[model samples]
Target: MWQIFSRFLALGLISFGGPAAHIGYFRKAFVDDLQWLDSKQYASFVALSQFMPGPGSSQVGFAIGYHKGGVLGGLAAFLGFTLPSFLLLFLFAVTSAQWLEISAVQGIIHGLKLLAVVVVADATLSMFTQFCQRKTAKMLMATTAVAIILMPSMLMQIAVLVMAAIIGGILLTRGENITPENPPITLNYSWLALFILCLASSLYFIGQDDTIGQIFAQFFQVGSLVFGGGHVVLPLLEASVGDYITPDRFLTGYALAQAIPGPMFTLATFLGADLWLESPILGAIVATIAIFLPGFLLMLVGLKSWHTISQRPHIAGVLAGVNAAVVGLLFAALYQPVFTSAVIMPLDMALVIIGFSLLKVFKPGIVWLVMGFAATGALLTLI
Candidate 1:
């Protein structure tokens, strides 16, 4: 369990390209490499996480850990995956104001933004191939894509998910059975106790306006309410921190969050650093803890019920629909943040096209692409 946690933690430190990409990384490591769970189980968990909310990739990580070693396993996975981003955000929240002023940092970020587009595009294609195998699933994918592109509103996205659930339920009236060839793993009481302890501590510490207290309260709320992944957290975080931090600073931190590795929730790092610089270290700590609290709680609740939930045909259908919609959401994200924000010139457009080609055609590792682009961007900035 500790070994698994250590591996996931290392992956979290270096993993970039958002939730979709994180899924790819997990598939490669856990499914393809580790053989921890079969493809079907993985698909089910991914679908379940997508349906329930609170950062899909993070939930996936927890599920992987849980499957491997029960509740303690889940905690290890969450900690391993989250720690890097937490540490990075802490440093950034402390130093971003100074570091971001550098032209090189700005240039590197600009280039990395284009890479984000390529990474997400690749992930969308991969997910569609994996999950949208059935004709009904394919239709859901197309419909959701059109709706998201046409509407592009938050409420509309939720409505699309709800409607998809209804449609999926109608289609999946006949049940599909998932037989576990191996015996089911038993839950560990110790892990459950620890999880409960964390929850209790968070609740106890979350008091009115104190730095740590506010962190606990705010993150707990976000974790509890956020349905989508990191992107969904953006507007919410902006609203929460905007009162204390400038819009420009917020935007800059957001941009930096995009460039770094790990979960997009690492945006908490920016919030923490901004608060820390603007106020105190206590503020930074509070902000960091607050942002991740919801996700942890959601994971705990979901794991308790996943066995029963995974069995229902209607639930499966909705997950199928949601997974398809996730593809569309990834597409929309590629268009907005990655393409719109970074690709300003003809050369920039060419670079993006090339990056997409490399990913789609060659399928080189993401790290290589990132490194190549970072160097290209640095050179471009000099020119």
Candidate 2:
């Protein structure tokens, strides 16, 4: 448990670039270095996260921990990975926003964004090599990437995954055994039941006169319904808390969430602090937990059953399609928010190339990569 916590805690401190980048970081750390799971299993976690609502990368991390050490491990991973962002956002809520104007701070953000580009680009190529081996799979991957790049919306993302699954079911299955050879893990339905119960309770309390209840209800509803991870949650969060939060403050919190390392969903921590006037810290805690709860519960429900269900021939085919589409999804993400956001100047592009080469050829530790890029970014400001 301590091992799980410590490793994820390390990631929490430096896993920037948002959900897509987090996926890349997790792949390199767990799949490539630690060997906690293979590429296929990691891809499966990523695919499963796509189908569910929550922070996509965090869900993948949770699944990895759960894979390694069960429910306790999953909880540890969640806390470890989310702690930095949670605390940072909470602090942002309490402090003045003027520090954002500092040149050094801006430079660090720029460099980390570039590092995200390098890491995500590496992950995309590696996953593409692993998943899109055949012509059909490759075609699926290409078209999915093109479609997402052209029309990038939550609805579009979901539609593409569904289409990929249907196509995979039709064409991907070959001379492969789909039978469950190993003993299957037990499927725990209690988590699903708890999820439903919480959903009901939140809805019920939302109508009451209690501030805390209202906070939980609103955030919980958002968590339960939101798809496409943290980025997609932004608009919904704006709607959920618009009554109490002003547009400018909301955007400010969002900007900070983007610049910082960790899950973007920690925007909840910032907004939650404002919701309760008497004790902002308590509000932050409640809001953070509420917003993240439903996703974790649903994840627990799915993880218990995924191993057995994925063994079925049809399900396996669907998974194959989803896996292929995930590569394209990451590819699309790499270009837009990850690459476009970071690579503004020609020097940035040059730095990205160098970073990618380092990742591919030298394979240095991510901590070193982060430090190097951050320092370089800060230095670039002086030039």
Candidate 3:
């Protein structure tokens, strides 16, 4: 349990760039280094995460922990991985925003964003080699990437994955007879019931005068409804909160969440704190839990079954197609938000090349890489 927590905790502190980058970091740490699971198993988890509605990358981490040590391990992974970002956003909520404006801080954020580009690019390439070996699969990946890059939306993402699955089910399964191996299969329906109950409860309590209840209800609904990634929750949250949080404050939290490590859902932590002035910390805690609860509950419902069903021949082909599309999703994300935002100058590109080379060749510790990039970013500001 401690091992699970410690591993994910180490990741939470440095897993920046958003969901795509978090997936990359998880691949390197769990799949590449610790051998917690093989590449296919990790990819299976990633593929499953897309179909579910919560924080995508965090769900993958939780699934990995659950695979390793069951329910307690999953909780440990969530707490460990989310703790750093939770604390940071909570502090950001109560503190002055002036610190965010510091030149050194700006430089560090720039550096980390650049690091994200390098990390994501590497993951995209690695997954491409593993999942897109066949010509059809490669074309699926390329088309998915191009389509997403051309017209990126949650709807488009879902459609692409679904289409890929149908195509793979028909095309990729010929002469492929390997049986899928899954961990002990245990279907738990109680979790689905609990998720439904929570959603119902949120609707009921949302009309009440209790501020904390309202906070919980709003975020819980947002968690339940938003699909694809954490960024999707932003607008839902903004609309749900009504006038309780000003647009400026909400955008500030969004920006900070983007600039910080960990899940962007921690934006809920910030908003919860801002919502309830009486006991801001309590608000933060409740909001964070509320926003994250639905996805985990739904995951618990499906985790075992998804693994079991995925091992079948036809379903395996479906997953094959979905996995290929997922690589493309990562590829598209790397260019738009990850690459475009970070690589603003030739110097940034040069640094990315250096960092990518080091990652591939020397393979330094992630902690050291984070520190070095952060330091370089700050120094660049001074220069």
Candidate 1, residue 135: how far the Cα is off, in Å: 6.1
Q: What is the lDDT of candidate 3?
A: 0.80
Worst lDDT run of 10 residues, candidate 2, spans: 226-235
Relative to the true structure, candidate 3 reaches a TM of 0.67
What is the overall TM-score of model 2 with all chains considered together? 0.67
RMSD of each: 5.5, 6.2, 6.2
lDDT of 1 by residue, 297-347 (tens): 555665655666666666677767766666666666556544666678899
Clashes of each: 7, 0, 0
lDDT of residue 256 for candidate 1? 60
In candidate 3, the residue pairs with backbone N, CA or C atoms under 3 Å apart (3 or more residues apart, or in different chains) clash, namely none
Compared with the true structure, what per-residue lDDT tens digits does model 3 show for residues 45-114? 8867776778899999999999899999999999999999999989988884667689998787678777
Local distance difference test, each candidate: 0.70, 0.80, 0.80
Task: Give the lDDT of residue 152 in candidate 2.
Answer: 66
Q: Give per-residue lDDT, candidate 2, residue 235.
A: 49
Off by over 4 Å in 3: 1-77, 92-96, 174-186, 193-295, 303-307
lDDT of 3 at 32: 96
